[model samples]
Target: MVSYITSTQTLSFARKPHPKEEVCGDDGAAWDDPDHTWLVISDGLGHGAGAAKATEAALSWITANYSNNLEATVRGCDKAIRHTRGVSLNIARINRSTKATDYVSVGANLGWKVQRSGIQRFAGDSGVVGSGVRNLKTTRVDLDGAGYLVLASDGLNTTSDVSALYHSTFDGDVSLAEACLERWTTGKDDSSIFVYRFT
Candidate 1:
């Protein structure tokens, strides 16, 4: 029950298992640009060295090569982690001018908060990068004045109740993000979360 930071407009944070010896490999990033804002979370398989490599590789490609082409970005990430593989990734990018968000994602589950509203949600059936293949879909959402985002791995919980969780938390505490992560996650996998809790 950590009091993770939640603010108006721009904010981001995450929690992962201790790296190295522990199999806790949580990979994540965020960027708010005049043209766009982007955030990524990749959970590498296993723990320690291998997971780190997979995560680092995926993140490097996504941030460096994210452009107008969402499909291209997905392909690039797949290719980068062909050898070391993992499931669950949440990539969110928001366009400043249009107030639109293009989410190029694969695997597990993701969620959102509209400032004062509680956490809403989304998920992928099997979004994993491997053999460096590009198998991603882009989802576009119109943003209100301000909204928050949470990219969580299945490790925290299974993805069975994604849509249900969204409808339920309409005016709850910001800590609800942590609630979803802990309540649903399996715990067997390496669980982690990268959250951009905004106002």
Candidate 2:
């Protein structure tokens, strides 16, 4: 078996709802197989029960079929949740051997990579997954060496301060991801951030 040194962290918070509400509006999953690592973030439509249902359906498909190609995996998820409210999701895959990263988005959540060279941003197109995507794009990037990758839900502002991610020592600190999650929280809705440090 081949091994790559990689660390992952995820931060998720629920949206405040009416007194009777008891569910979070967003969900995410991250995992690594022998060959591939995946990061997924989903926001259900709206901010309560309906949204939670949509995300559950979407995540079920994502978890089961993530081994497939990025486009096909997303299409499968879309079909699986068509009966529900629908969701906005961002999916990312990293090939452990090649250090190649492929990501696709069908909603408002987005992804970014911080590398010694520069930062690469991946933004979503307009559409709700499980409903229909009028426009969308798949992005591919190669990790040169050690780098940090972040995928965030719409609750967090994309333009907020990210200087911490640029510091060279960020990757060395074990708490790097936790500090980032705190710095990026928008506090307005159900928010989440998935961090991957690949070496």
Candidate 3:
């Protein structure tokens, strides 16, 4: 399969509670040095301001300290919210030089993929965030084989039927990603997604 080394990112957030409840939020950024870019999504435990603040804090911390060790960053975030426990996150670091990607999660949903010609998926942690769970995984891409990194919260209700969005085609992942999130994020919890485009 042909791979891509491009990196593109897009995200969507749908307000929940059908009106005021917003359950999800996402953010991402790449470095100019080609060292790596960061993608992070944090689902606050509850709804309203409390949830928003929790998720916001998580992303802020990630971007602020992404230059450090990823595992330490994950562990640090977990320790800070031991009591409030309003965070579920998936943080990925894509390195241009090594073609290595590292992911750190805490009670968040796992990841899914739309490889150039294949589909892969991972599940979520059973418990809530702030439970002192350190679930992390790292993968290396061919830098020219894979094109996108797709991740979403469980609210999408699409655990089993993701084929419609992740077909084997040359379609841009940002477009496909937004379409899927718009369809899946309709619950009380806000629906959020983060897509990374690869070169």
Candidate 4:
């Protein structure tokens, strides 16, 4: 588990590997620039060393070359891990000043926005990174002050209601992520959850 706190937001990430595997195949990261905060989640094709390598490559590339252009960032990640096993990837950029969020996703990743009104789901385009992507597009939404943003790998069930979970397990971001992992993980794959709270 890892956590990041800023004046405008708080981010927490939690991950677990398959019971039989020594390394986790899912990877996540959150970072802040002067004007924006970037959040990413990557799940490799399968569990083990090969899977870990693929996600690591994707994260490394994003860390080094990320820009405001989300589509270009996804394309760059695809090319960066072309030699390794493919991965499902999601990237979200939040404008610090405006609280507007831009999101891009591919393959089986999941995203949701939890607000006082309701939970809004963001579905990914169908394609594995490092293979090929089709009909790629970015989703933009206003976080609108105080709310929660959740991103998870397919290893966790996406069908559950995230806002209810937030209300039921209303701890800090770290506890929320752990609760999601414990309650929804498939137990057959590497699972990961990222929770971001912005005010």
Which should have the higher lDDT, number 1 or number 3?
1
Span of 10 residues, lowest total lDDT, candidate 3:
1-10
**Ten-residue stretch with the least lDDT total in model 1:** 1-10
Query: Which candidate should be chosen as best, given lDDT against the real structure?
Result: 4
Cα RMSD for candidates in order: 5.4, 4.9, 5.8, 2.2
lDDT (Cα, tens digit) per residue for candidate 2, span 10-55: 3222223323456766777767777877778898887788988888
| Residues 87-107 of candidate 1: C-alpha lDDT, one tens digit per residue | 456777767667677775676
Pick by TM-score: 1 or 2, better one: 2
Task: Give the clashing residue pairs of candidate 1, or none.
Answer: 8-199, 23-47, 78-132, 79-132, 82-131, 106-127, 107-127, 156-185, 157-184, 157-185
Q: Estimate each model's TM-score.
A: 0.71, 0.82, 0.72, 0.92
Better of 3 and 4 by lDDT: 4
Q: Model 4's lDDT to the true fold?
A: 0.84
CA lDDT, every model vs. true structure:
0.60, 0.72, 0.56, 0.84
Model 1 / residue 190 / CA error / Å: 2.3
| Candidates arranged by lDDT, highest first | 4, 2, 1, 3
lDDT of 3 by residue, 104-163 (tens): 555655466556576666544444455576455444444356555666655556553455
Tell me the tens digit of each residue's lDDT in model 4 across 17-64.
988999999989788888888889999999999999999888888888
